[model samples]
Target: MDAVHVHMTNTSNLPVEALENEYPLRMDEYAMIQDSGGAGRTRGGMGIAKQIRAVGPGIVFSARSDSHTVGVAAGVDGGRDGRRARLIRNFGTPQQEELFSKTANIALAAGESVRIETPGGGGYGAPSARPQPRVAQDVADGKISAEAARADYGLSA
Candidate 1:
């Protein structure tokens, strides 16, 4: 029989250095996507973006991801929905393309790249119920923008 591996969740705690050392790839970017979390009194968790570039021969990509077309779940009590996931090929280039959430066997040449943005968690309550201090802190910490604070949480400058 052939060997198979399965995961209980889409999340992984693998470090970029480990991946780069193990595979013929280079980490182009790996960071949390700002404002990707659902807005609420208790805000949802943020999503992450990871971009990898092929640096050697014979690199192929595949994934069975979700939440690309819709949020993880509907928000509760007037809370905003979570941001959806995305898989991009050659991001920031004129030939950039958005790929399917579930796809397999994408050929990657040297210098070509792929980016995956994971879905954020759903919010639990109305965004207006969130405190101004928390919103300000989020903005200060770069979790959300000042404009997002004003628009989503009704915070004033």
Candidate 2:
């Protein structure tokens, strides 16, 4: 496995947004990988989902995040491994395609989008150890679905 990558962009060549006056290479969506965090006495932190849209030409996308298959953080004390991470492109469009875990520079056209889903943290204990209130909060925050809260955490509807 490779270390987490940190990306840097040169702002001088980037096109500015008409309203915000900032480059279009900004964060698009933010969410948690539902039910991905390990279930335990101390629930693991949820993985994050992020999207970035290319608003100009000459943009290139590159990444190789593969927690999706191998699993993310490993749990302790009999806890399980967290879900894997993923990298995808064109999400809702017909062109939507899943990308490899590792990629080099690939040209990105305007209006195209790239999405990344990070793996969740591993839990420290068993699912039964998680408190009901925390499960409820996770549901409200969209970190986990109501069904997951009930099925995984044993929370009531």
Candidate 3:
């Protein structure tokens, strides 16, 4: 299997110091992608996007899925679904950029950074087929609002 690996150190007062001390590089920022989940009957697993701003010049390597389009996960029988993954960066730039490569390796400067958008899980069945308890749990967990869950998932939450 293919994978992306990153090495960095932290120079700030953030909790990342431990990582920096443990690693051989420094990092200015790190975060996951916003929303990249899929929708399907069984709900495919969500993709993961990570970004790290280099505190200094360093090399970065990443491997990700090539399918930038989000697709509905195949449901067991019939269930509501989830959305796909979409990646965007430098939205204000005169021209939009799309990074659909399965692997990326580059040297970044202090102010340079990369954004990764992962895919979300797919729905298991028809939206109305989901259980009320599941919908309620989603609401409680802040994954979905009560109104949305009720209207979309047909739950009482």
lDDT of 3 by residue, 32-131 (tens): 3222222222333444444444445564645455445534434445643443444443223454455554546754455454555444454555666556
Ranking by TM-score: 1, 2, 3
> What lDDT score is found at residue 130 in candidate 3?
57
**Residue-by-residue lDDT tens digits, candidate 2, 1-157:** 1112232122122222442255546556756577777777777777666777887888798765455566468989866666677788988789999888788797889888888777777778887777788778878977778887777778987
lDDT tens digits, residues 45-100, model 1? 77778899999979999988657864374578888877777899999999899999
Order by lDDT, highest first: 1, 2, 3
Candidate 2, which segments miss by more than 4 Å at Cα?
Answer: 1-26, 66-71
Show where candidate 3 strays beyond 4 Å. Answer: 1-44, 58-64, 69-72, 80-82, 86-97, 102-107, 145-151, 155-157
Alpha-carbon local distance difference test for all models: 0.81, 0.70, 0.46
- Tell how far residue 119 is off in model 1, in angstroms: 0.4
Winning candidate number (lDDT)? 1
